[model samples]
Target chain A: MTTLHVIAHSPFGDQRLASCLRLLGADDGLLLCGDATYALKAGSEPLQMLQAANLGPRLFALAEDLQARALDGTQVIAVDYPAFVELSLHYDKVNSWL
Target chain B: MKFAIAVFSPAHAPSSRRALRFAEAVLASGHDIARLFFYQDGVHSASANIVAPQDELDVAAQWRTFITEHSLDAVVCIAAALRRGVLDDTEANRYQRPAVNLPAPWELSGLGQLHEAAQLADRLVCFGGD
Candidate 1:
């Protein structure tokens, strides 16, 4: 499954991010950071469509996604600037999955 | 998903770092990044004379290293960079300048590159001011 992390901090909000999310198939995961409420507002409708379609691992807001990952003891797929740094630091560890 | 990021803020500012970090994050997420375009004041981030205080991080160096490490296509709008005195080697010679400050791993190009990036990328993320 592909994971997309969107860092939305521009005045244009998350319109671009939302459009990308809408284009993804059901098995994709979306991780949003910074101005997430803005992403939620921009993506609400498309997210509902994906949910209704029963697409797996759809949009994940910060808190809910983190908490769920913690409860399941699983690493959540995330896209964001800081998250990229973390991944780069540990590329070798995750190379097998990639 | 494939993505592109457009940065429009001056270097050393919070917004600029935020934008760079965001681009780094997008790449880390295991998705493809088509390009990183610097427009308006954001082109200044490619300037080589950007010396930060000892206490502050060297943003220009950071961006250079990041782009080189990732082999990311980093383009600065030629018109904007020239207007702001950020010159490439060719432009510096054209203008008969003594030194060229615009660093490597960042190319100067027209807005057509930006348009091409938008067309190629599934998501074109813009950072900094409107």
Candidate 2:
């Protein structure tokens, strides 16, 4: 019954990230990719809030996206395509927040 | 496992192309595709009138052939498709449009169909939006 939520927009621009956050449940996991990787910058309050609110679910960001954005020391786990595939397989459903 | 795919970008968009590749890979990996739902600008993929230059890749055509070959259900959101001017013969007649562009095998449906597909499939994946 776990849902894998894939978010691809920046928190600063699109409301999708917020909507994703609001919809996420205790059993759901979050993966930040594309422009969303920018949210991992150090000292982002929203990012911190996301971390605090969803401790029961796993949080991840795309490593390739992070590298593209030059974002390092992200609080969320960095994952590659293989990890992405693994997550998709582990979860019962995937809800892409696009 | 059964999967339902949602495409949220136009056929010409890079993300749309990527979605095709992903779906191909999933099928090659032996997964079953329950449905391919087209939402937002992705409804363009169902338009039969789409024409590409001989040199460029005809994305819509590719989707048509693939869907036909697999006997997959490709559902385009009727509301979204109408707003975007992608219409089937029935819709065209209702609206008195000059032409109908939506082709066979790609059916116009409501969002409820997408919801049903999500519930029926083991996984629901999406491509290209936001």
For residues B1-130, could you state the per-residue lDDT of candidate 2 as single tens digits?
7778899988777557656766776687677888999999999977898888888899898899999999999999999999999999999999999998997989999999999999988888898753
Q: Is model 1 an incorrect, acceptable, medium or high docking prediction? A: incorrect
- State candidate 2's TM-score: 0.72
Model 2 chain A: weakest 10-residue lDDT segment is: A48-57
How good is the docking of model 1, as DockQ?
A: 0.11
- Model 1 error, position A50 (Å): 26
Best by TM-score: 2
lDDT tens per residue, model 2, A1-98: 88899877778886777777777888888988777776777778667767666644388876777887888834677876556656777987788876
Best by DockQ: 2
* Model 1 agreement with the true structure over A21-91: per-residue lDDT tens digits: 55655444444444432323433564454345453444444443334334221223443445444433332
What DockQ does each prediction reach against the true complex?
0.11, 0.34
